[model samples]
Target: MRYNYPHANLEFAVEALNISDESTLSSEDFATMMPRIQSLALRTKQWVTVIGGSRQVIQQLVNAGVSRSRIRWVAGRDADQREWATEQALLAGTSSVVLSFLDALSSPRVAQRLKMASKVSQTHSFVFRSLPSQSPLH
Candidate 1:
């Protein structure tokens, strides 16, 4: 794995992979996506968001000796919590917003909130989503 430890913190769009804890996805997906992340990271001054709730990945980054000062991992169950996370990320100058469990909620309210976050963040923010197949969200 090409681990870039001690990444500088900034804001960028988040892209989600399989997203949910429901799937045992591979690291290859992340490898494939990282080039894009790296490209965006190079073009702009922002942090790339790895959209998932996997403590393993987070821990891996930490274990790889990535600076905690540069990365913020958002984990919670409420949409409002996510909203709060968005705000925190912006304040922290995060560059990406990755949304997992996209099919967990179909309410336009959530989508609107995320959209608003992106809008509010301007080009500094990007959103990545992973939707389930034929799923009904809460």
Candidate 2:
């Protein structure tokens, strides 16, 4: 199962997804998400915040057709804390979408904050959580 949030004028989707590795998204899974990000970025010609992906993943996204110039990688030590990154993105005021490989919707407060932040910033937040193989978080 995938978590979802509502954002008028912005699209948010989550589907039953699985990756071969429990820790990272497979190439195919990652590939499946690029076009949507690319589409959003290309429309505004603004940066797209990509949170938590490593250098290899970022490079793969570039090679797979996501614009290199439009990508703003945010794989810092605190990247897992989606709220902070989303706050930073909102503060920047130049990005149209913030794609985070995190469980932003896992916490009620974070989810609510993200909703308000996206609305105020006029941007979209797409949080991606690796489907847990064992127990659920919520």
Candidate 3:
């Protein structure tokens, strides 16, 4: 697996990668694999988001080394908020991956706008979804 380790202290996005973490590596060694978290999840994209993911899921990913700096963690405080954040990030030309559980709540109108934005900005978007949500709609 690959990883992306952008400098947190730097003013600009400096893309860096580490391609391998051997079998003998320890938990501390995984810090070396932190960028691997991003590269594996993000691919050619620049960011990853946990859209409508429960708080626990978001926390676990962070504990597992997906840099908090690289994630736009969304708890669905509301659907509009998540969609707005997505739109803003896409407008800023951030290539992004979304781990979405609220598939039905996605805004097609917002998505259409994002489609235009992505085309204009030349960005990439990917969504990794498996289990669906059971939470009652508000």
Candidate 4:
């Protein structure tokens, strides 16, 4: 299924983007997400923070048409650090969108914290997870 950004009432929302493979982050899926990212970036003119994204993934986002200047790639080596950074980015309200590629978000507690933070800061957040044979923003 194609994932499109919800155009209305986007604030205070935290969603998930499930990927089947992490080793070979599929370009097709990443391409599908670009439009939403681009739309959010263009609409808000704010930074989009990417937590736990590798350099290759960052490059893919740039290749998919998101401006390099508008992206803030945060590569936290520690899982706790990455989760903390993701929450902070959402709570800070400096970024219009926060995209977290952390496995730790699979935890309900972590996801809940992020949801609250996004709501409090009114930031649109997307967390990427590795789930088998599924690729959709839920």
Candidate 5:
């Protein structure tokens, strides 16, 4: 679903991208979404933190027109660390947007914590997950 950025305050907005497999995120999947992401970064001119993203993915953002200096690519040692980093980034108010790549949210409390942190800091958070196919035949 599309989120209205202008009215994003205090809202737990989520946008999911469909992928061929639930275990991996392909370059093509991210490439397709680059334009929108790039536009948001450029328009806002704010720092963006990417948690658990690869070097290639970060390069793609730079190649897509986002300033390399404005992007912070974080590689957490583990899932828990990644979640912690995401929360800290939001709560610290150092980034205007935080993109997290995870297999799945560990728990509802995690989501609640993220939402509350985003709300308090007024930072936009986007969580990208590789969900199992919804098709019954899959």
Candidate 6:
């Protein structure tokens, strides 16, 4: 699959997809997988938000052809960081966001805030509710 950027001198060519053994793969391998995934994202023309995940995963998506303008990385942290990240994510209408550690959002109020951000963003968004780490507080 090849995707031309919506507006700009950018394009992505993608092929091959392997859903198995993703964790075991090295960083280099992940880099190779990125383009394929990004092609799918481009085809959808929707904002992709990754919540509760790692910066590495988000970076991989960027490498795969996902535009920075269409990505946001958010992880439920404390009140201030969460609010700041949420605001930034919403402002970035077409960017993918990585919201890591969903458990950090222990308040209903925070959840409501996230819901509002989702509603206002006019692009495709994705949320990663979990990551490789586990917290006792959660």
Separately for all candidates shown, the number of backbone clashes (residues 3 or more apart, or on different chains) is 12, 0, 4, 0, 0, 24
The count of backbone overlaps in candidate 5 is 0
lDDT of 4 at 53: 66
Best by TM-score: 5
Cα RMSD for candidates in order: 10.3, 9.0, 11.6, 9.1, 8.2, 10.4
Greater lDDT among 2 and 5 belongs to 5
Pairing residues by index, what is the TM-score of model 3? 0.46
Score each candidate by Cα lDDT: 0.44, 0.59, 0.48, 0.67, 0.69, 0.47
Clashes of 6: 24
Segments of candidate 3 deviating more than 4 angstroms: 1-47, 63-65, 95-108, 127-138
Measured against the true structure, the TM-scores of the candidates, in listed sequence, are 0.45, 0.62, 0.46, 0.68, 0.69, 0.43
TM-score of 5: 0.69
For lDDT, the strongest prediction is: 5
Q: Candidate 2 residues 1-138, lDDT tens each? A: 322334424333232121112433443465586776666656666787877655766676577566888789876565346557866785576886776666434455655666566655667656666323344667
Name the runs in model 5 displaced over 4 angstroms: 1-29, 130-138
lDDT of 3: 0.48
Q: What lDDT tens digits, residue by residue, belong to model 3 across residues 42-88? A: 45436666555555556666776566677777665665775666556
In model 6, state the lDDT of residue 112: 57
Which candidate model has the greater TM-score, 2 or 3? 2
Summing lDDT over every window of 10 consecutive residues in candidate 1, give the lowest-scoring window.
Answer: 15-24
* Model 1 residue 60 CA deviation in Å: 6.8
Error of 2 at 14 (Å): 15
In model 3, what is the error at residue 85, expressed in angstroms?
1.5
- In model 3, what lDDT does residue 51 have? 56
> In candidate 6, residue 133 scores what lDDT?
47
Candidate 4, residues 25-138, lDDT tens digits: the string is 333455567788766766666787998766766776677666889889888877788889988998898887787776544466776787777766767777665223334767
Residue 50: error of model 4 in Å?
0.7
Total backbone collisions, model 4: 0
